[model samples]
Target: MDFERSLDLLWRDKGETPQPTRGRKPKLTLDKVIATAVALADAEGQATGSMSQIAKELGVGTMTLYTYVPGKAELLDLMVDSVLAERDLPGPGDPLPDGWREQVRLYADRTLTVFRRHPWIQGMSMVRPVLGPGLMAGQEYLIATVSDIGLAPRKAAAAANGIEVYVQANAALTAETAQVEQQTGQSTDAWWGQRSVFWEKYFDVDRHPAMTRMWESGGYDVDTCEAVDEAFVFGLERMLDGIEALVS
Candidate 1:
């Protein structure tokens, strides 16, 4: 992953770039390269967001691009961090939203916005964090919000992590649903409707008591992939309620 190079570039300031050893007078910055990579990934898919493709998009040679950044691995770290900055939430010095729950909602809302904007990000693995400023900043903001609710520091971090876990999974679900529609050329409703026979002809109430009960009890009112957003909202609120309970 070009670990050292990626780590160094991750912490580099926006204006700071790699010093190009004597050559044709450096023509690009690491930020610009990463920005182009992000744009490419946003417009096309991540597969097309490679180093060669980035240089093609930027109208520069791949070697020239390499001079600004080490390799695709390093550039990806920068791109993920860059896209994450889109949240644009209030950070350390700025005032957080009214209540702790409200602040958490704000975090959820901003995160969903970015995920929807860059659905490609949903497919990527963040198994290891980039630990860049953009990521650390959001982490700091959420930790502060959770701490404000009077939880211990470690617990506050856990709450923030747990909240983000749900948020990210919800985002992946929604994004993948969209991806499926695009790939299969069938909208979720149409795809889901094609399987209605399973419920009508194959589903047996006696075989699945909980499913039958929930369906009869109107618990499936917001069911199905069509109302995924509403379901996510309900789940998020319930999660917040649980967190609120801890302090109460």
Candidate 2:
């Protein structure tokens, strides 16, 4: 992919690009094309969302879309960056707070928020890095926040990447679980309830003492299940503790 061209399409002044001389003025802008593609992908999985589908959504010919966006890959790139732009980070000139740990926590929460809002993004293959303006700014902010805590450049990047990966993976699991619940019309607790009869009948108490003890303690009860939000906080704090050890 031509990174420069993609960046131009994402961030540069649209008027600066030379207009076509012979053809009628294009009805669709790049933003419109990308927005339409994003909506299609959000509603349907990326595999089912195609150039033809986006064209139909925009009421334009498939070939005409090429005039605005080069192809699906580039369009995907733009879509990812466009969503990244929606992240409610601090404005350009604002200084990051000095509380590094809390800042990292907030960053992870924000990332998880993005993932939950656009669950389809968790499924996208990041084999090709799309360093559009929005993504670049996010990266800079994260690294700078870590660096402000006195970590070296390499460690800062690693720390930021680790937090991001943890948040994304957890958020993806949460989203998938929600999707399953929606499709099956059964909550996790309801599914466990359905299986409780069989479990009571055949559960091996002698062979699995630990499992037996946990069940007796009501650990498997629906009300005892760890909330997703609590799990996230617990895991995040533990991760930060490890990083804090290195910092100390």
Candidate 2 off by > 4 Å = 1-4, 13-23, 45-47, 95-98, 178-198, 201-203, 206-208, 218-226
Ten-residue region with minimum lDDT total, candidate 1: 14-23
Model 2 residue 2 CA deviation (Å) reads: 5.4
lDDT of 1 at 21: 37
Task: Residues 1-248, candidate 2: write the lDDT tens digits.
Answer: 65666777777554685342233579977788888888876665432588898999999878888777667877788898887777766555886555878777667777677766665776665545577776776777677677766677789789988876787678777656655565477877788778888777987789899988987897665341366767888898998898888888
Report per-prediction Cα RMSD to one decimal: 2.3, 3.3
- Model 1 CA deviation exceeding 4 Å by range: 14-16, 21-23, 222-226
Q: Rate the local accuracy (lDDT) of all candidates.
A: 0.78, 0.73
What's the CA error at residue 50 for candidate 2, in Å? 1.4
Candidate 2 similarity to native, TM-score: 0.81
